[model samples]
Structure formats: structure tokens, C-alpha cells
Target: MANEVVVVMVPFLAQGHLNQLLHLSRLISTYNIPIHFISTATHNRQVRIRLHGWNPNNNLIQFHDLDDPIVTPHPIIPNTTSHPNFPTHLQPYFNSSLLLRTPVADVIRSVSQTARKVAVIHDSLMSYVVQDVCLIPNAETYIFRGLSVFYYFCSTNMNLGRELPFEPDKICQLPAPGESISPEFSEFIKLQYDHQKNHVGNVYDSSRIIEGKFVESLKRDQVNGKYHWAVGPFNPVEMDSDCLDRHICLQWLDKQPARSVLYVSFGTTTTFTSDQIAELALGLERSTQRFLWVLRDADKGDGSVGVKAAGPSHEKPLFDNYQTLHSTCRSVGLPEGVAGRGLVVREWAPQIDILGHLSTGGFVSHCGWNSCMEAMTAGVAVATWPIHTDQPYNAILLSNVLGVAVVMRDWEHRDELLTSVMVEKVVRKLMDTEVGEAVRKRAAELGGEWRKSMADGGVTHEDLNSLISYIHK
Candidate 1:
């Protein structure tokens, strides 16, 4: 063990970024490599808690707390939730990352003192890591692309103004009709590359596409001398947590017929207007299909859609909470009489377990990368309702290119919140009948292939070995 290598994993503060990177780290540990996971105290504690729950090989995984000197003292808006007419508040987080140069660099220096090869694996969004972490004398730096391979292709070429086949102005969907992006794709490219110049690291993406036609297209891209190393779609298997009643839902699911239930959840940051949530709630009820929806209470804070102020004229006590809203669901637009068919998971739901259940047939998701991978890994086809960021693009991949999901609405499709009537139709198509059955079979087949591909002699397994070899050098 004298020559054992140690790595540092630095994920952006967001929940999605942390989850993916943690899984990636766990996967790396299976090869018997040790890793030091670094983040703010709050986030590191959360990761520690989650890892302890998984009961993995703990000796290989260590957590370090980095103090955010700048933002620790400053609380900009009293409210952390997303609000109308307020400026986007992401700049503060970016500022905090830049300020971590001292503590993070010190950690690097301490690790370099040991008799081991050291490397830093960081989220692409962390501009400071590229600026500072690479400066550490002997440690190599690599970026973990938490986004899809599709985004990587678009970001690289689009930065070079390489005349992409798809129009940059429109939301870049896959095969057929699709949605649009914010700030547009081209602009997004320039801003990112500006921070990425002169960086020291290899690029690693979470995409599972490297084994498919995407590999060929990626080869073509590499001819231009820009390349990303594939060590992923680092899919998570068997999630367990103290957050919810892990057994109740699964026990209830066992009684349902095969492919009978649809699982619905938007990731942590996703939110909807009251009108939209009501429409969605009623849609589940009216669809008459067994479903589990994790409509968490908005009052918990963080960025989520909030209800508008009610006028004095309306006698109804404005619906401020999901639990209360559930009680009088009819007042807020749920269809009458369907409680027995659906369960509202307000605490937390073991997402991976639920997805893997035989009774779970379909997913109605916001098309986040982690959620998409989970559904694919579990062989559950999806009903896409993308909300923002890279989601519209993810939806296209699932519904169009992969043929594993069907898009109900792109992220920006907001003429008005979709009515319950619209919801029922989409749910039915995803859960019951000829089209759903076909997609379900396709998803299962792909899942089997992906699992095989991650095993011994598989594509990702080899790529991971290559990554480790690269770090050793």
C-alpha cells in the first residue's frame, strides 16, 4: 500500500452536483483508491451522513470541511427561496468559491506532504478550482462534468463558433420538436470558456453515451483537439436513508399490479406555481393510476416556486403549505375522490428503491441528469416535464433520441400551467397501453445493457481504469 494514490473530490454546493460526485467517488473507491471529499461544513456533513447510511467501504472515503470565508458572514436576502422581481443570487456562491483558495490550497499542501500521488477532481462549475487548485505543486487537477455528454459536445464546439447543426437560439432538443434555452447556448459557451482557459486537468463526463453513436461523434470532436474523458454515467444503485419510511411505500407497491404505478418527483430546486401544482395533483387523481408524488412543503426554504399573494376578496385561506393543501385538495383543484390511488410523500422518498420496484412503471420527472439515470438504471420509462437549465435538453434525450421517455412540456412551456386534463392523458400514455409497454421494454433492455457495461470488461470500467492510470502518471 506504500504507492497507494489518494484523490480529492470537490463538488459544487448544489444537491445534484454533490450527489453525482459522491457516487463517482464511491465508484472510484471500489478500485481500492482512497479519496478526500472537500466541501463547506454544512455540505460535507450532509455527505458524511449519506455515506454512513450507504455503509460502503468507509476506510477509503474521508471528508474534509472547508470554511467559506466570504459568504459565511454575509446573508444577502433574508429569504433563500426563489422570488419574482429579484435578481438571480448565484454570484454569491461563486464568490465564496474564489475565496476558498487559502484553505483548499492548504489542504492540498498537507496531502502533498504524504508519500502518495495526489489528484484533484472538481466540478466544472467551480471556476476557483481551475484557478487555484491546479497551482498546487505536485497535484494533478481534473474536472468532473456533472452535465450530460450532449452538453459537453455543445459547449466545446459552440465556444469555437463551429457552426453547430442545431440552431443555438432554439432549445436544443434531440430528434423531433423541442424546447429552448435561457441566455441561449452560444452565450453560455463564451462565458464558461472564458473562465476555463489555461486550466490543468482532464475532462470527465457523467454521460453513459460514450459507448454508443455518441462515441463516434465524440471522436470527430476530438479531431479538433478538444476531448472529454469518459468515466461515467456513474449511476447510483440501492439508495437507503433515514429521511422517510423506506418500507411503507415499497410494501404498498408490492400489492399493485406490475407496471401499474407512476412515480413523480421534481428534483430539490424545481418548483411550480400553485396553479401548476394543483393541476398536477388533480391530474394524478383523475388519471386513476397508482402514483407516488413527492410534493415537499415549500416552507422548508431554498429556491422553489411560491404562491402569489391572495386577494382579500377570496374567502379561502390562501394555501401556504402542501400538507394543508393536501387536506383540502378539492379547493385547490384536485379532482374529487382518488386518495386510495395515490400517496403523497411529504417527508422523503427513497428514490432509487422506488424506481427499482417492479410495480413502478413510469416516471414523471423534470429531466435532471441524476433522475434520468436512475429511471434508466431501473428500467422505468419517463414522462418528461422539464423545468429549466439543462433539463429541456435532457428531456429530448430521454423522449426523442433514446426513445425511453415522452415529453409532456419543455422547460419554458408556460402559456399557463398545464391543466389536470392534460396531466391525465400524459400519465395514461406513460403507464398503460401499447406505447408505454413498448417504452417500458426498451428502458429495461437499455438498463440491462448499461448495468452490463458498468461491470467487469465493460466500457465504464475500462474508462475508470484509464482515469486512475492517468492520475498515477
Candidate 2:
């Protein structure tokens, strides 16, 4: 009888995590392992809409949705740019991880009867609960850190006492840029770690659990244990060019001058209020730099309080120029002359092609993991503007540690209070400053390093193969 393998992926309630887990599933399923992707009901709807058209019902790939306790209380928040309700209102899903473990375990048990073994890939932030659940029979667990190798390297070496990884209080000598992380960025790193740590409870206990798991996995690898995998990002077992789209932004990019355009996006899951949108717009315009901005539509939950049909419409008047915008797309509004300024404001542009374009010189981004990876891979320097969650942390590492990026600010607010002056300063620095040039050079070099990391017999490739071998043992 052929041995079967079942893999369970439990990700945080965020788009970045969802994308990463799905990519991992795609990689492992190629080995003929049965993969079951688990997510909440709302997230499942999102997957169905965005990724469903891509063909998900193949023999090896399947998806499942679990119950969400706060479903009714948490109405779906729509994103004008990316898929709807993605990263905006992050419901308290940490409390639900344990609640989700049983249903997931039962699914694994049912699949394992016909399969050879079972594996669980847990996002690093939720590793504690996922690992606990994996004490079940034939189940192995691994933590997936959705960050770059640079950030990972910095994190592994952080000590919170004498020297915090990113505390502003230290005014001491800055850590080396690109070669090492500076104290300026370390405060944000430490803050992000604390935010995640708080969700899991006492830091000491959490560290103990994490350390113990690593030690056990190392020992298992020594004797070739059945429950160990150190996989990071995924690679196409075969690079089928046909599987990718080729003609959209690349053709446009082939015509523009190098280092002239700024690529702008807030990521698939993050959302901002209309005021914040205007502030950002003014910033972009005042900076006098040409850019491609992906703007999210207005969120209607707050205004939809009592009206049945007028949901987000009630709040539309708040935007001064909205009267000019037709509801043709799920947009809040576009300021006058926005279309004439060499700006591309589409909901979704061919990102891969755009990034690959020679004309695309820099990125003004939300510092999401996938975006960071894509930008680095494209050799594009970045103007980092982080919002919520791990974005600030990622921004710090990218700007201060790697020297490939520059941060606008680490603070985020729902109100549209930031003046146009702030945006002008950031935009000018990204487009014309000497700092920007240095960052661009370093980014190009790192992009090459990233390609090397995933090439055959590279660090990431070896890691993935070792993970697969460890699990099959």
C-alpha cells in the first residue's frame, strides 16, 4: 500500500500569512503529499474569490474553513484595492487557535489512516498553540517566519537587556547598516516582538517552549527523526514560464527611463480611512515624483450602522472630491489631476511585471513580507512607510539593517492628519537624495543574494529538502 501524508497549515488572520501558507502548500503538494489548507469562514470566501479562479481542486490540493466566533460581531470590511476585508480589521483570532486545533486534528486523523504520515506548518507568531496541538499521533510541526533572512539573522541575535534590538532610548552608537542592524531600528523590532510575545503570554515560558522544540528537532535531525522541517519560502520544482503571465507591465516598463518611477502599494490586507488616504495623496503629489499608487476603497462598516443599503455610502460625502468619482470601482475618491500626473492608480497592476520593469526605480510600500521579498528580488530600492502589525518591524530592518531602504516614519494613525510637507520630504529623499542612491545599489546587490539563496544547492533549497527528508523519516 502506498503511504499517504497529510499537512495542516494554520495561519494568523492576515493576508501575508495566508499567502505564505498557500505558497508552502503548493511547494509540498508537488511531492504527492495530500495538503489540507485550513482558514476561517471569511478568509475562505476571500480565497475562493481571489485564488479560486486559479484552479484549486486538483487531486492533491483541498481547502477547509473553520467557524469564527466573532463572525456576526465582525462584519466584513471591504478593501477597495486588493480583495475585500483582508488586513484591515484583524479580529481577535489568537483566542481561536486552540478552538481551531481540534477540528484540524480530526481532519488530519481521518486523512492519516490512508496516508503515510501527517505534518503541520504553523506561522511563527502562532507556533506555541500549533505545536501544542501537534503532540497528536503522526503529527509534526514547524514554525514559518514570514520575514527576510536579514531580519531573521538580526532577530536570532537580539538581547533585550543591555542592548535592545531597536530601542530609541539608546542614543548610543548606531549598529552597522546592511552589515548589521542599528539601534534606531532595533526599538521597533523589539516592539514588534513584544506585541507577538504578549499574545502568547509570559516571555520566559514562550522562549522555553520555542527553545525546547528547536533542541528536540535538532536531536531528531541527528538521528533522522520523523517530525522536523526547516522550510522557508517556496520554489517552483520546475520553472514553467507558462505558469506565469508575461505581457502587461513589462511592455510599459520597457519604454520608461530607469530609476524614474516610484511603485506604491499598502499591501493586500491593510486599509486606511479616507483622511489618511488624502494625506498620502497630497504627500505623493507635493513630492513632485511620478508614482504608481494602489489605493484601497473606503471601509463602510462604521457608516452602515442602521441603513440597509446605504452602508459605506453614508460616509462618502466626507471626501471632498468624491462627487467626481463614479462608483464604477470600489474606490473612495481620486483627487483632481490625479490621472494626468503620470500616476497609475489601478486596483491591481501586474506587480511582477511592474517590479521587473527597468523604469521602476523605487518602492513606497507598507513593508509587508511578500512585498519586501518581491522588491528585494527585483533589485528595486524602497521608501518604507509601514502601517500596522509587523510592517514597522520589517521596515526598520529593511532600512536600517540592510541599507537597501529608507523609512518615512514608523508611526501609524487612522486620521488623515499628516501634512503634505512630510510626504514631500520623504518623496524627495527617495527620488533624488544621495541616501537613496546608496540604498538602490545595496538593494540590487541583495536582490542577487536572494536569487542565490533559492538557486539549486542553495541555503533555502537545502533547507526545504532537509525538511522534506526529516518529515518522511
Candidate 3:
């Protein structure tokens, strides 16, 4: 076709990351470029099954399977199963040390020669691999922060020591672009502060703890002497490509007034206990605000002790409290007026489309970067309630600093359920007063700028063109 260019996306095997990268790849492929989505066999298989097939039009797009030796005892080929949970499909990928210099160098040597040129768009968390991957003469690597433009700037500025620029030895009240960041109840800031006290300098570096435990094992693959370029997502872009669903959520939006609907989702991965779900249901019921929610069958306990599937991993079993209450819910279920009082629950949702709807004024999000990006681009203010990982950090940035998102009840525990009163209070504030208006105005302004950035002569548009140019070089 138009000088085939291969764009390999290496996400952290989570739905949030996968969704964002897939969207980016679709954006590139729309320009008539070929995309050979190289992912672990298990994940690729899952994609095929979920989408019914990889190629819908049978045009310039295709999927290529890669072998990870460490996946199973078979190394190159292993049996993968179809599991309900998505992360289970990623288990095999966790064993391969793609970040190690030797393997990465080998992968480049193998793939680089196949295409006229190769461009690698990797997650920022996988920065260690950029060293070796970018070394190939024809290779150019990009670091996708996948968060907000401002958050990216903050992360880059947040250094480790005197040698670094803004390294805090403790939970210092660091300043944002325009305001002072207050730790308050942000578990992210609290944890970062705790981390600083326990381990000074390199506050962002959690290599030792996270490695082997998660994809951090990839860090072992870093090459010895290689230069890695770090580029932040400081430039915001509204992904308005035709690749997105156009009318999925518009009808729903047409029925609601501006700033009335509260969007609630805990992202693709974060699940909740049945009790937590009940609490959340009760909360939404109490709030009396119109809402759309994506609810998954997740428990507060570990269920991964036995099942071995090829798809996403299941959450831990429910806590003891849920074990007893689960039966109760099974019998009585949701309150009688809950559904009619303005709540629509679904297993899966047209998220990107929903956020962009004009009627969607506020989001109750887990603060995943992809969700944040979508909300920001759509001009929807957020109601932050982060669960784990970098979500807490994202939530803090959105609420305390950005002044766009409002925090509900800080991260809740199984024992500490978020009551209906807390939910109603947050929802009322998001819908009724000046604070809501201010947040809405800020989000709209930000979204408008982002939309402009992706136009023909805009900053993000130029950045994308430059990315293509780099690949051709």
C-alpha cells in the first residue's frame, strides 16, 4: 500500500493500555499505513476471538504473532485458553524479559529488516527497553505517557535529588504548574510521601519492588550502554479520527441536560467486592443523580488461586464479609427504586463515545491514564476515586492540582465501604453549584484546545506527522 510501516505496540497487558494503543494504531493505519500488531500469542488470540477477526475490511491491516520463550515450557508455542477475565491472557507475556538488552536487540534485528522502516511506540513504564530498541539505525522509539499533558509535565519535573530538579526527600508539598499540590487525602501523594521517607531520591523508581512481581521483570533486559530518549505527553490531542465510534452514545446524551449525568466506571481492570458494589449502588441511589456505570463481576477477594485461563485474570475472592452478604444480595438484590432513580448499568460500555457526549458533564473514574485522556479530550470533568497502580497519582493530579476533578471518598477498603451519603454529597456538588460550573468550564476549555491541537496545522497533528517522518527516515 502506501509504503508499509510497522507500528508495534507493547502495552503493559492491561485493558486500559491495550485500548489506548489499539486506538493509536487504528489512527496510524487510517493513513493507509500497515499495522502489524505484535503482541504475545495469548493476547493476540484473545483479540481475534473478541473482535471475531483481526481484519474487518481485509485491507492494509494485519496481525502478527510473536513468540516469547518464557511463556510456557514450550517456549515458542504453548497452549492458550479462553478465559473470561482479560489479564489471564497476559500471564504468558509476564515471563518474557523483553526489556533486557540482548532479547530486545535480537527482536529488532529480526523485525527491522522485514519493513522499509520500523517505529516503536512503547509505554513510558517500559522506558528501560527504549535504550536498545532505539539503537537500531532504522528504529525510532516513542514513550507514551498515556496520562494528562500536565501530569506528564509534573512527572518529568519530579526528580529524585539535588542532582535531579524536584526530588523530595519526604512528602513535600510540591507545587503544580499553577498551584501548590496539597497531599490532603490523596493516597497517591501519601504513598509517594511515604516512599520518599522510606527511600530517598528516585521517588519514581520502584524497579526492585515491582520487577519480577509484574512487568518490571522487563527492566532486566536493558542494554548496558545505550542512549534512551525520554519524550513526555505534554502535547494533548483529541483523538477525533474516523476510527472512533460516532453515534454510540449520542441518543442517551440527547435526553439529558448539560452537566446532569455522572459517569461511573472503575476502568477495565479494577474490580470491586460485591459489598463494595452494593455500597456503590446504594451511593448512586442516594445521590439521585443520573448515571451510567460499567460494572464487572469482581470481588474483593482472590479467585486466582486455581483457574488458569488464557484471558484476563480474575480478582481475588471476596472478603469474608462479602461471602455472607453475597447470599443476601443474591436473594434481595438492588433496592427497588435504584434503577429508576437514574442509574444505567452495563457489563461493557462505549466509553470513549460516552465521554465525548455533550451531556456527559462529570466522570467517576479510577483515574486510569486512558480514561483521563478521553475525559480531558471530551471536556468532561472527573469525579476521581483511584484504586491502585499509578491511578492514585493520576487522581491526585486531576483533583488537587488540575482543579477539574473532585475526589469522592479517598480510596476505599473492603472494611471501609463508601456509604451512600458520601456518594450523594459528591454527586450533588458535581451537579448543583458554582464548583461544578467552574470545573465544567475548565474541562471545556481544555478539550477545545486539545481539539485544536489535532487539527491540520495543530501541535499534535504536527507531532503525528513528525512521527511518521521519523519512521520513514
Instruction: Write down the TM-score of every candidate.
Output: 0.81, 0.70, 0.65
Query: Which candidate's lDDT is highest?
Result: 1
Q: What is the Cα-based lDDT of residue 463 in candidate 2?
A: 55
Of the two candidates 2 and 3, the one with more favorable lDDT, higher being better, is 2
Question: In model 3, how large is the Cα lDDT of residue 188?
Answer: 23
Task: Residues 222-307, candidate 3: write the lDDT tens digits.
Answer: 33322222121221233343453433234455688876788887765554544455566667767777776655532111112111
Model 2 per-residue lDDT at 272: 55
lDDT of 3 at 416: 59
lDDT of 1 at 344: 62
Q: How many collisions per candidate? A: 2, 8, 18
- Please provide, for model 2 over 332-383, each residue's C-alpha lDDT reduced to its tens digit, 9 standing for 90 to 100: 2345655433443334444555666678888888777677766776778888
Q: Please identify model 2 stretches exceeding 4 Å from their true place.
A: 51-57, 67-70, 74-88, 125-135, 147-162, 165-232, 235-259, 297-354, 357-359, 411-417
Top-scoring candidate (TM-score): 1
lDDT of 3: 0.50
